[model samples]
Target: MKNACYCVTEHRAPLQRIIQDTPELTGDQVLLRVTASGVCHSDLHFWEGRYDIGDGQDMSLSDRGVTLPLTMGHEIAGEVVALGPDASGIDIGAPYLVYPWLGCGDCAVCDRDEENLCPNQARSLGIFTPGGYAEYVVVPRAKYCLPLGDLDPARAAPLACSGVTTYSALGKFRDAIRTDPVVIMGAGGLGHMALRMVRALSGKGAVFVDLDPAKRQAVLDAGALAAIDGAAPDAADQIRAATGGGARLVLDLVGAESTITLGLAAGLKGVRVVVVGMFGGQIKLPTVYFPMRAMTLEGSYVGNLKELRALLDLVRSGALDIAPVTRRPLHDANAALMDLRDGKVVGRVVLTPDPA
Candidate 1:
């Protein structure tokens, strides 16, 4: 059997099409016929070869152990086509959302179901291993496959990343999301997913901030309490006014220095700020304010397997509205990545297998 894939043969270069033998499965492994794969902003960093870490320096993915000729779509949903001898419990014809954040299964973190946080070695798919930008993908474990039920494959694909990332971040705010208007930064894919998850979780609603007028307007039309221009001189004041005071729960989906500064400026004392975006940059703030304001600032990575399952349950119950999705053929993977890089995508973009 043959597997057709689009791979990153070099940084900042177009993905090259490669055909190879389909991987053989073993030790509870499962083989999927790639049904849908969502293009993510993180893929841009991998393609560009580094992350903007503020000042004049950047963090290279190569330094962090990423190698080339990599397949780079982590938000994947696919149909079961074959399985190893030990693989069981999931049917061959069923569709599932693949959990891409993996780790050394013997570690303490993995034992606690926090594989995404494993400090030993990051084995995340689309990063450390082959991923779903192809006609066939090999999952190392059947446990990573979560049933999609009746959800659309393209829409369900992002639940593995954007959906679960926002859900887990919102989970950190706890009941604060219900008591106050949450301040959300960046109205891109993650921002829109955060907004929908807030409403689905029964939060008080969100006040969005973005530099793009179109994105700001898009979220406003989607039911944000207010959409303020993040570049506006009085942007903080606008957020404060929208929240009827300062925001108590602020979710920064864009981790740039300016966005973090805006979020801090717009937050009330004792506020909790969760930074989830990898846009990358650094910020400087007075140390005294940490105690004086009783403020909290932390970062959240993509969520774990348990959270993904919970998020899927929420979607299955019809409580969480799936983010808007744009579909393209698998052959357009390079175009999809470029569009996302240029800030042209309104929501998630999923790549489907090219028709035979």
Candidate 2:
């Protein structure tokens, strides 16, 4: 069988369609006919081939073990087509959300179900391996497939990334989130996901900050306590006022220096800020503030498999509101990426498989 996929043949260039023989399944491996793939901000980093780590420097994906002609999507949902002899539990033809943040199975972190924090060579799908930008894909193990039940594949696809990412980030502020409204920075895809998840987790509510008025309005319509302009002169004041003083928890989904600065400025003493966005930049903070303010800063990567399952359960129970998602045909993968790159995407843009 032939598999067709769109790949980043060159950095900052158009994705090229490539046809190759479908991969043969090995021990414990499973084959999937990709039903939906989400276009993520992370994909932009892969396509650009580097991360702006500030100081006029970049961290190249090649140094991090990414190679050309790679398919760049980690948020995937698909139907099982074939299973290896050792693969069990899941039946053929069942639709599932692929857990793409894979790690070496032998690591201690993996043993604890924290594969996303694995130290070994990352086997993350779409980054270190072929991903769901294709008509078909090979999952390293059946264990990576989470049953989607009745969830729409297009809507469920982002659960692999944005959903689980925000879930894990919010989990870090359990105490604060339950008692106080979280200050969410960036109203992009991840920002919106974080907003919805805050409510689902039984949090007080959320106040969103973004440069876009449209996205701010969208967040307001979605029931956020307030959506302040990130660029406003008194943005921090607005966030502080909205939170009734200062925010106890801030989820920075846009990790740029300005966003982080804004988050810190809006934080109350003992505030916990979790930076989940990959929009990179550097910041310099006074050392004394950490001790004086009792502040905590941390970075959260895409979540572990266990968190993905937990998030899925929330969606299945209908307690979690789905983020706005726009569906496009798979053939428009390049266009979808461009839309997301140009800041034109509202919520999430999911690419559904085009008919064979």
Candidate 3:
């Protein structure tokens, strides 16, 4: 039993190919034959030595001690074939969503359903261990896999991460805050999908801000009420003005010092700003305005299984239209990552392990 895999050996170098024994499933693990995995921009962040987010096993450099040389693919989907009897309630041969986060289950965070925050936690099938880049992945806990019936597995993969992150960010403000108008910064992969989600979940105000003319138009085509140029000299004032004094909610999907600065610049007095991007930047705040405006700033990471389920329902019901996907062979993972990094592809690029 042999398996093929794409392994990232060094920073910026192309992933090398390797053959290994087919993974053995633990009694508590569910083994899935890899079908589709989305090449995410975040994966590039790791490859380029930009973002140091992982469980500290493979990284040459560690953030709080998480390392790299890891098999990359966080957002993944496939069919389950084997599981330990201890892994009850999950049937073999069922198509399921893989929740990548693997946590210390008995912790306070896990008990509260915030496993991403678990002190001893790490995401599997990507960040923690050999991920979906290979033909097979061993999932330690069956509880994390969500059922995907009749949905295109390729498109569903990105929903596991990009979709879940953006949707989770929007979910909080979907019901409570001002829905009259909502603003999304960055019209890239996640931003485009967010435009669709906002329209589906929160129907009041839909405004998109992006530096790319093509992306700006795409957001508008996806049903944004207004697509303002993010690079406009007075973009902040323009956004603030367009939203009728201010947008109550602004999702900064491209977080960086500049965009975070722009977010503050474009935000209303009482807006809720959620920063979800990993673009290596910081926000500078004015000490005086923090208390006076009653504005809120929150950071959201990839969502948990509960949020993934809600997002899947939206996708399953056809309320959210995922961007069309582009396919490539497993060996072409480098090109897929490069395309995503260079802004050459739309939607997501999904890699098929067995392209026959």
Candidate 4:
């Protein structure tokens, strides 16, 4: 079989169509026939080639070892079409979600199954390696393929990224989430998924912060106790009011300057703040505030395999309402990306493979 991949040949330019003969896989690999891939916000940064790091500075993906001609879709769901000689466990033709945040398997973090936090090397699909924006993908190992069971491929695809990312972040402050409504920043895909996971795991809800009136309304409709305009000057006050004095836990799904400041401001003393978004922008930290407030600030990358399993269990149980999804054809990848970049997408947008 030949692989037809949409390659990012240049920054901000449409992806170049590249066709290549599918090569024989190594002993540990599994070949997946791409079923659906979710367009993620981080793809914008990759497409643009750099991330804003505040005060006129930007970080280049190339500097970080990402090359051109890359296929960039990490949130993937597919069917196992082939497997390597040594690969085992996963059945061919069974649907599965690909876990993209990979690390060198021998690392201490990877040994603990928190490969997403691996600092030495990142072999994450669609970022450091070729990903799912194509007809097929060769997952490095069968272990990365989590079975979808009864879940729809379009919905399950996002669980690989948005679902697991938010789920891991919430697990960090599960105690606080169980006691009080955590304050969540942003109501986009991550925020929406976070809301559903919060209700599922903690039996509580959240107060959403977003500048978009429509997003705020959508989160409210999704069962957020309250929604505050992030652009409002009194946004922190509003969050504090909604959470009673101050929120015990704050999940900043938009990790830009404005949301970071607002999330921190809306927290009580001893509050734990988890920043999970890659929206990218530096923040000015108050040195004294850490001690004065006894704050805990943690950065959560996308989740690990074990967490993905737990999340899948939750999703498969049908207890939580999955985030609303908009389906688009695979060839419309650029248009779907543009919509996400323009903040026009209310929920997640998944691209289904073209008819065979």
Candidate 5:
């Protein structure tokens, strides 16, 4: 089979088109025909050398390295054509959302459902390996691929990263803040998704904070009862007032020091702050901040298999639908990324390998 992909030839050049040969399917792997790949902010970070993935074996390590001539696209979904040895429960020609994050399953973290933090983890179809930008991808571990039953392939792509990240963050604090209000910062892909996931997962608090009026409106559209600006001097105060003097949870998808600090201020007596954005910055709160408010600041990457499953189920049920995706053909990958960088998107952008 022939694979046609787009690559960033050099550091900041435009995405160039390339054609390559496909290796024969390995016994432990399956060949999947590329379908849809979401234009994620993380990819833009790599393209712009913002994430600073170095030239290394692990994509997370070389978050900014982003060496040249890479076929990139991680948030992916496609149909499986062939499989290799011990690929037991997988069906040929089934549509699946490639989990992409592959980790050594033997680690203690993986054994305890924390595969996202596995030491030997490597991402596929984008960063660490030849991704779904082409016609095919080699899924070494078929078990990691989740079949996309009735879900639209295009919309399901972002669920792998942006969607899964929000779901996992909200799931972590669901039990602690069952009926308390929560704060979500930034209303872009991750923020918007978190608004919906937080409300659906816990049916609890729904406070949103963002600088962009357009994004703040998106938060309201996604069912947030209150949406305000995190840039204002009184932002945190407003959040506290809306949630009755404080919020129980605060998710900072922006990850800037200001946003993280606002999250700290917005939290009440028993609050949890989850930092998940890579906005290229750090946050520091005084020792008294956490101790006095009894606040917890934790960071979360995407998520594990169980959390991804719960996200998939949420989308599958009518309870949650991140659909109405703005889609374009694979050839338009650069344009899509530019859109994301400019904050011109109201919803997630999914790049379809095959034009409809």
Candidate 6:
């Protein structure tokens, strides 16, 4: 079989189409007929070739070992087409969400089921290797494949990245989430999914913050406690008033200068702030604030394989509500990415090989 891929031949350039013959799989590998793939904001950074790292500095993907002609879709769902001789416990023709955060299996982190935290080699699909911006994908191992069951492939695709990322971050402070309403920044894809996740997993609710009135309204419609405009002069004041003093936990999904500043300002004493977005920018805070307010700041990357399975279980049980998803054909990936980068997408956009 020849696989047709939309590859990043050059940074900031449209993905060029390439067809290559699918070769025989090595032991433990499996061939997947790509069913659905999500267009994520991180793809924008990969396409642009660098992530802004505050001031005038940037981190280049090329310097980090990412090469051109890359197929960059990590949030993927596909049907198993074939398996290697040693690949076990997977059924052919069954749809599953592929866990893309891979590492060398011998690492300590990988041994602990925390491959996403692997400090050594990161063979993460779509980033470091071939991904699902095509009709087919090659998963290095069956362990990376989780059964989608009755979940819609298009809707389930984002679960591999956005869903699991938010879920893992929320799980970190589930106690605080259960006791008090958390402040959620940004009402885009991650924020929307987090709203549903908080509802399903915690007793308390979330007060969402976004600059866009439409996004604020969307979260409000999704049963958020309150949706505040981040651009409002009284935004931090509004958040403080809404949370009664201040929020105990803040999920900074925007992860930029403004959102970080707002989270810090709106936080109560001993507040835990988790930054999950890749919208890179730096912030400055007085050193005294850390000790005086006892605030905690943490950065969360995409989740691990165990978290992915747990999230999928919640999704399969109907406990978790699926976020609104915009479906586009696989061939329209470039346009879909441009739309996402331009803030034109209301919710997550999933690319399906067959858009019928």
Cα RMSD of all models vs. native, in order, equals 1.5, 1.6, 3.4, 1.7, 3.5, 1.8
Error of 4 at 138 (Å): 0.4
Q: Please, what is the whole-model Cα lDDT of each candidate in the order they appear? A: 0.89, 0.89, 0.76, 0.87, 0.76, 0.89
Predicted structure 5: clash tally: 13
Candidate 5 vs. true structure, TM-score: 0.90
Give per-residue lDDT, candidate 3, residue 289.
71
User: On residues 23-47, what C-alpha lDDT tens digit does candidate 5 reach at each position?
Assistant: 7766578788878887776777566
Order the candidates by TM-score, highest first.
1, 2, 6, 4, 3, 5
Number of the top TM-score candidate: 1
lDDT of 3 by residue, 1-356 (tens): 57677877786888877787866666677888777888987777667665523333233434633455678887778788778667887878878778786567678878776777678856545766778787777777787788888888887888888888877888768574344677888887777777777767756757888888988888787677788887789888888887878767888887766776776777767778888876664455887777777788889988877888899998888888777788887888877888877879766889876665
Per-residue lDDT, model 2, residue 147, is 96
Single out the weakest 10-residue window by summed lDDT for candidate 2. Answer: 187-196
TM-score of each: 0.96, 0.95, 0.91, 0.94, 0.90, 0.95
What TM-score does model 1 achieve against the real structure? 0.96
Per-residue lDDT tens digits for candidate 2, residues 187-233, read 76677778778878899999999999988998899789999998899
Candidate 6, 160-222: lDDT as tens digits: 988899998998786778888989999876787898999889548999999989889988997
lDDT (Cα, tens digit) per residue for candidate 1, span 197-244: 989999999999999998999899989999999989999999999999
lDDT of 4 by residue, 110-143 (tens): 8888888888888899998899888899998888
Better of 1 and 2 by TM-score: 1
lDDT: worst 10-residue window of model 6: 347-356
Which parts of model 1 are misplaced by more than 4 Å?
none
